[model samples]
Target: MKKKIGLYFGTFNPIHVGHLIIANHMVEFSDLEEVWFVVTPHNPFKKKSTLLDDYHRYDMVYEATKEYPKLKPSNIEFKLPQPNYTINTLVHLEEKYPNKYDFALIMGRDNLKSLHKWKNYEVILENYSIYVYPRITEVENIAVLKNHPKIVEVDAPIMEISSTFIRKQIKAGKNIKPLLPLTVWEYLDKMNFYR
Candidate 1:
């Protein structure tokens, strides 16, 4: 059987508790063998200035997920082109991992609202299965994409936390102990990040 991997791609600027929670639930409830946090060097839609360095972000993820054997920090996009497109990353991962891995793009319902705007969005719909988690919105209308037979709506615990919120707190010199994992918090303190 092919190893089912959930590609949880994001900036993961600090890899907070909310991310870990969702990843844990993804594994517990789904057939995914592992959930890889594909850290994107840059997001085309977002401002790059606000982002922490890619290596810093990746290191934080490594620290945050160290305890979870099923969670991995993938640097595949680090070597790829800037303003990385999800479709391209998926295609590359499919070829690179070959028959050993099958991927599901894990995302929040909030992202689904603008999924049509993504590069090669239709190709993504036709090729890979999308697993969406609930966001702040209670009513998610996946029915709009009901035509896509591969979409999967997953009911996972939704946290009200976000990396932006955590970063803001950190910049304001507030304690973010509760926002991230203990190890991550320690590492951030030792490294003097987000100061």
Candidate 2:
């Protein structure tokens, strides 16, 4: 049987507890055998100025997930062309891993609402399953997708915690240690990041 893997793509500027919670919940409660944190080098919609170096962000994800057997850090997007889309990564992963892995997308409710705007979104919907976690956001215009057969809503906790908020707290010299895993926090502190 192919290993079931869920792709949790993000910048992971400084991976924190909220991310762990969601990823863990997905693996524990769903059919996914493992959750891979696919760190993106560049996201088409996000600005580059605020993003830390790709390696540093990847390192943080590595540190954060090292303790969890089912959680992993993947820098596959780093070697791909800039402004990589989810479809491109999904395709690449399928080819690279061959028939060894069944890949699915792990996303939040907010992203679900905007899935229609993604590149080749229809293709994605037809080819892969999506596991969505709840988010406290104004969801709109996703009725068509909400009932899609491939989309599964996981009863995971609503994690409003964001990397941006953690960054701000670090910049303000506030104690943000509790938000991150110990190894991740140590790496960020040692590098003096976000300040």
The clash number for model 1 is 0
Each prediction's whole-model lDDT (CA): 0.88, 0.93
Candidate 2 lDDT by residue in tens digits, 1-195: 999999999999888999999999999999999999999899899999999999999989988988899999999999888889999999999999999999999998889867888999999999999998988884773878858899989999998899999999999999989899999999999999999
Best by lDDT: 2
Q: Quick one: best TM-score, which candidate?
A: 2
Least accurate 10 contiguous residues by lDDT in model 1: 138-147
Q: Residue 120 of model 1: what lDDT?
A: 99
> Where is model 1 more than 4 Å wrong at Cα?
139-143
Cα-based lDDT at residue 63, candidate 2: 87
lDDT of 1 by residue, 1-195 (tens): 888889999999889999999999989898878999999999999999988889988988998888899999999999888778999898889889788888889998888878999999999988888888888865557577755677777889988999999888998999879889988898888988888
**Which stretches in model 2 have alpha-carbon errors above 4 Å?**
138-141
TM-score of each predicted structure versus truth: 0.95, 0.98
TM-score of 1: 0.95
